[model samples]
Target: MKDQHINRRDFLNIVGITAATTTAALYGCAPKDQKSSGSKASSPVPTDQMTYRSFPSLGEDKVSLLGYGCMRWPTIPSPDGKGDLIDQDAVNELVDYAIAHGVNYFDTSPVYVQGWSEKATGIALSRHPRESYYLATKLSNFSNYTRENSLAMYRRSFSELQTDYLDYYLLHSIGGGEGMKTFNDRYVDNGMMDFLMKEREAGRIRRLGWSFHGSSDVFDEVLALHDKYHWDFVQIQMNYVDWRHATGRNVNGEYLYQELEKRNIPAIIMEPLLGGRLSNVPQHIMMRLKERRPEDSVASWAFRFAGSPELVLTALSGMTYMEHLQDNIRTYSPLVPLTDEDKEFLEETAQLMIKYPTIPCNDCKYCMPCPYAIDIPAVLLHYNKCVNEGNVPKSRTDENYREARRAFLVGYDRSVPKLRQADHCVGCDQCNEHCPQSIDIPKELQRIDQFVEQLKQETL
Candidate 1:
C-alpha cells in the first residue's frame, strides 16, 4: 500500500523500484542481471584529494566526507563467458587510491557482489595498517532469517574482512519485505537487535545503526526508539530529486534529514545520484548545469547537495571505475558546499525533470547477466535515454509518433540484441527475487515487449 502522503498521481519517483526485491532479498541473496563480459586493471595514484567531515560520536573525528560503498565492484567475464567475477586486483587499486587521497571509511555487506564484497574489501584494505582506515560491515540477514544465522553472519564479516573490531556496524536493509513485520521478525523477534546494542557497549562494534529501505512508518518506528537504542548514525537515500519529489511508500529526503537532525543523529547518505539518473540527465536540463559550472560534472551538483547538509557524516558513492573514483575524490577534496541559491536552482531543475518518464535504474548493473540472455540494463537505458531525447511515443495518431516509433524500435534493436531482448524473458521471476531495486523484472520485460509489438503493428 502507498503511504498516506502518496496520492493517485504522486509518482513515487525513482525509489519506487525497490518494493519487489526486498521480499526476495529476505533470504539474503538475490539473482542480479549481469551487464557485460569485460573487466580490466585499475590504476591507483597517491594524492590527498578529498574533504573531511567530523563525526565526533564515532571517535575518529576526521572522517573523509566521501565514503566508499563496495556494493558495485568492477568485474571481468569468467573463463566460460557465462558469468562475471570480481576483479580483486582492480578492487585493490581502487581502494589504495581512495585511502591515499584521504578517504577513510569503507562500507560493505554480506550480500553485495554475491557475497564477496567484504572479502575483496578485506584483501585490498588489509595490506594497509588496520588503524589507517575505518571498516564498516553489516549483519545482513535478509534470507534464512534466524538468530543463529544472524550471529554466524556477524562473526563471518569479521573473519572475512580480517578485522576483529568493526568501526561501524549496521542492522542491514530494515523495513524490507513486509515492512514492520519483516523488521520485527529479523531483529525484534530474533533478539538479535538487542544483542547488537550490547555488542556496541562491548566496544567490539564501534558504531551501531541501520540502513533504511522500506516504508516511512518503519523509519518512524525505528527512530522513535532512539532514546532506548541511541543510534550512532543512520543511512538513507538522499539526493536532489528525492528531497521533495519522492514517490511510493518512502518519504522525502528533506523530511528524513530533518527528523534525524531533530533527534541529533548524524546521517550517512546513499544513492546521492539517484542510481545515476541525476548524472545522466535530459539535454535541456544538462544545459542548465553547464551554464552555471562548465568545469564540474553533472554528478557533483548532487554530491554537493548531499554534502551541504550539516548533520551528514559522509556521503557514500559506489565508485567501481578508476575515473569514477578520481572524479568523486576531486569533488569532495574541497566540496563547494551548496548555498541556498544553489538549492533553489536545483529544485527548479528537478521540477522540469518530472515531465520525462525515465526508469530509476542507476545502471549499477546489479540486474545484469539475465539467465534468459536478456540485456536488462541496455533495454531500460535506451528507453530512458530516448525519453530524455523527447522521442517517447504516446499515441499513433500524434504527428511525431512515426518518428518516435522508429527511434525507439531502431534504438532498442541496436542497444540490445534480438535474442537477448525483453521478448526472451520466461517470467520465471528468479531475477526479481535478487534485485536490490525491487523492480519487477519479468513484468517490465513483458510491458516493454508489448510496447515494441504495438509500435510494429501501427502506422503513421
Candidate 2:
C-alpha cells in the first residue's frame, strides 16, 4: 500500500493538462473535498496516472477509461437482522477510494440489486461535488412502459442519484423479448424516446443512449434512429470472448462496435469480463492469458481488450469488492492497448472458449426470485465450473467418467441447494426477457437438470 503519488510533471504529461488549467480542467468534475478515514493506508495505484478519454461531444468533460458499474455493490447483514443490506458505509468507502484513485464515471439502474443500487450510488457520490463525477442511470421500465410509468422512472432516477442533470442516460436492456416490437412498446410507441430526446435538449440528460441486447435487426433498427434521436453514446457487451463468439440471439461485439463507430457514437462497454467468466477461465486458457502478462490478473486481459478500441469511452466493471476495483483501476491507469498480434492471440482464445459450451450467464441475477425459487445463475455457473475443471464427461467410457460424475453431482448439490437446483425450472420462460446475455434460462436449467438426473441414474 504505497501512498507515494505520481510526480506532478508526469501526471500533467500523461493527461495532457497544462499546470495553469490542470485543477479546473481535470478536477472540474473530479475533485474530492475530503478523504475517507477508513482508507488512510497508502494505495499501490497512483492517483494521477489514470487514463481518460474525451470526445468533441463530451465538451470539457473527461471520462475515465474505467467506469464503476454499480449493479453489484457490496452488502452486509441488515441492521434489523433480516436479509442482507447494501453496506452503505462500505459503498461510501469504495466510492471515496475510487474517486481518490481517479475513477469518476458511476453507472447504475433502477433494477439492479433488486432496486437499491442507484440510491446507494447516489449517497456515496453525493458526498463529492456534482462536478466531481459523471452520474449515469437508465429508464428501466421493463414491465410497465406507459408514458406515465416511463416518465416516473425517468424522474425517479434524478431523485435517486441526487442530480438534476444526468451526464449519461440510457434505455436499459433493449432489443430483447419481442425485439423491435418490444423496443417500440418500451420507447418508440410509448413516446418515451421522444420524451428522452426532449430531456436531452432541455439539458437534464447530457448524453442519451441505450444498453443493447438481442436481435441484430433490432440493433440495426435502433442505430438507424441515431439520425432522428441522436444517441449520445451506446452501452454494449464487449470482451475478448464476446467480440466474435457471442451466443444465443446476441450479435458479435465487433459488429456492434462497428455500427456505433460508423455512427461516430462512442461505446460504453459492459461485460468486459464476460460476467466474471474471464477472470475464472478454464485452467488452460488462464495459462494462455498469463503467458503474455504474467504479472497482470487474467481479468486484466479482457479489460485491456475492451479499452483498446478508440471509440470506447469507458469500460464498466461491476466490482463488488475493493480488490476487484483496485485491479481494474491499475489496468486502466495507463491502458496498454493490445497490438495486432495480441488481438490475433485473443481471437484464437475466443475460439478455444467456444468449445466449452458454458452458458453466457453473467450472474447478473436479472432472472432471480424464480417463480419456483430456482437459483439460475448458481446452477449455470456450477455446470460451467465443472466444464472448466474437466469434471464434465461426454461419455460413460471417458477415462474419468466415474470420478467426473461423482464430482459434478457432489459439487452441484453443494453449490446449489437441492430444492433450488435446476430440476425445479418449469420451462415457464419468464426469465427469458430479463437476461442481458440472451440466455434461455429455462432451457439451460432444464438441460442441466437432465444431466444431473442422468448422473444419478447411472450410479443406481
Candidate 3:
C-alpha cells in the first residue's frame, strides 16, 4: 500500500464502497447506494498553486494556509465499534500527497481518532525526513486534571508521535468556567506551565500555546496571563460560519480574532470548514458563491476565507482520503484571498448561518465514553444536521418535517444507550470547556432531550 497510486476511477470506487458503510455508521442508517442520489464524488477541480497564503509568524514555512487535520482519520471495521482502527495504507497516501504539494504542517492530538492519531501521525510523518515537515499535538488533559496525568499525557504524545521533539504543543480544548478552573489548577498551579517552559528551553517543544473553547472572558483571562507566560502561538476555532456566529462571543458582539491580534499572538485555526459543514453548502449559499466564482468547489470558499488574512498561522482540515487531500491542496496551492466585498458577503452569510443553530461541537470527541454509555457527540451531530437541512418542523402539523424528526429521534434512541441520552446531561459542564465554540452544551442537551420527549409523546 505504501507504493500504491490509486487513479481517479479507483479512488471513486473505493469511496463508493466505503461511503455506504461509513455513512450509515455515522448517520445510523442501513448501507445504501447513494452515489446515484446526487452525492456523487466529483472529480478534483483544478486550481493553480499561486493562490495559497502563508504566515510569517510561523517562520515563513510556506504552509498551504490550509493544513491537514488528523482528528477524523478514516477508520476500518474493528470489534470495538470505533471504526476498527485507522487505515494506515490510505493514511500514508493522503499524507504523502499533502506534503508533496507544500503542506508543511500536520496537526494531531492525544484523543483524535480514539487515541490512534499520534501513532498514525508518527507513521505517516516518519516516511519523510523530520526537517521536511512540522508536527503539532496538544497536551490533552481533559479527562484527568492531576499534574501527573498532564505530564504523562505529554510524554505519551512524544512516544506516540515517534519524535523526540514537537514543533508545536498546545493545551487542548480550553473551555467553560469550571473547566477553566480545572485548567488553572492542573497547569498553572501544578507547575505544568513551568514544565512546558523548561521543555521549550530543552528544544523538545518548539512553540507553546493552547487551543480555546470557552467564552471571550475565558479568552481574555488567558491572554491577560500572556504577558507573564508569553505564549508563542494559540489555536482557535475560526471559520466563515463561526466568524460572527452566536458562539465564539461573536453573537454577543465580541470579536475573538481581534482580541488575539490585539495581543500580537498568531492564531492557529481549527474547524476552518466548521466540521465540514462549510465544505458542501446548501443550494442557496452555493448559488451565491457560484455567482462570484462558478468553477470553485464549495470547500475552496473556506480556504479562501481562511487565507484572506495574514494573521492566521495555519488552518487545519481533517483530510481522510487522497482526493480530499488533493482537493484541499489545489484550493490553497495558489491561495485566493477574499476581496473586501467577498468578506462582507461572508459576514452576512455568517449572520444567516445563525438562524440554524447546531451544536457547536467540532466532533473533536473530547467528551467521550459517557459514563452512562451515551454517544453524546453523535446525537448532537445528527440533531445539528437535521437543523441545518431545515428538516425540523415549526408546527406538528407539518407531517413531512415531523416524520423527519421522528426518524432522527427513533434512530438516536436506537443508536445510543437510553442512559446516555442528552437527558443524562448531569449539568457537569465538563464538555463545555473543551468546546471552542463556547456552546452551553449541558443546556443544549437538555433541550434536545425535551424535544425527543415531545416527539415520542406525539407518536403515542
Give each model's whole-structure lDDT.
0.75, 0.79, 0.68
Q: Summarize candidate 1's per-residue lDDT along 1-460 as a digit string, tens digits.
A: 1121222122212111111111111000112232111121123333665777776676755788889998777665554444456667677788888988888999999877667778778877888888888889987787777999999999999988888899889988776688788888888899998899889889899888998866788899989978888899999989888899975445689989999999889999998987667766777887788788876767778889999998998999987666667767767877889988999999998898777777666554556446676767666767776787767888767788878889889977766667778889889887765455667778878988898898888855
**Regions more than 4 Å wrong, model 2:** 1-43, 77-83
Measured with C-alpha atoms, the lDDT of residue 212 in candidate 2 is 92
* Candidate 1 regions with alpha-carbon error over 4 angstroms: 1-46, 363-378, 395-420, 428-438, 455-460
- Cα lDDT of model 2 by residue, 77-191, tens digit: 4434423466666777899999999999999998877687787787778878888899899988999979999998888888888789999999999887688888999998888
**Per-residue alpha-carbon lDDT of candidate 3 for residues 294-393, written as tens digits (9 for 90 to 100):** 7666677777787666677778887655555665676666676788988898888777666666666666666654554456676677676666666555
lDDT comparison, 1 vs 3, better candidate: 1
Worst 10 residues of 1 by lDDT: 19-28
Which candidate leads in lDDT? 2
Give the lDDT of residue 425 in candidate 2: 82
- Report the candidate with higher TM-score, 2 versus 3: 2
Looking at model 3, report the run of 10 residues with the lowest lDDT sum: 18-27
TM-score of each: 0.84, 0.87, 0.80
Candidate 1: deviation at residue 86, Å? 1.1
User: Candidates 1 and 2: which is better by lDDT?
Assistant: 2
Please estimate how well model 1 matches the true structure, expressed as its whole-model Cα lDDT. Answer: 0.75
How do these models rank on lDDT, best leading? 2, 1, 3
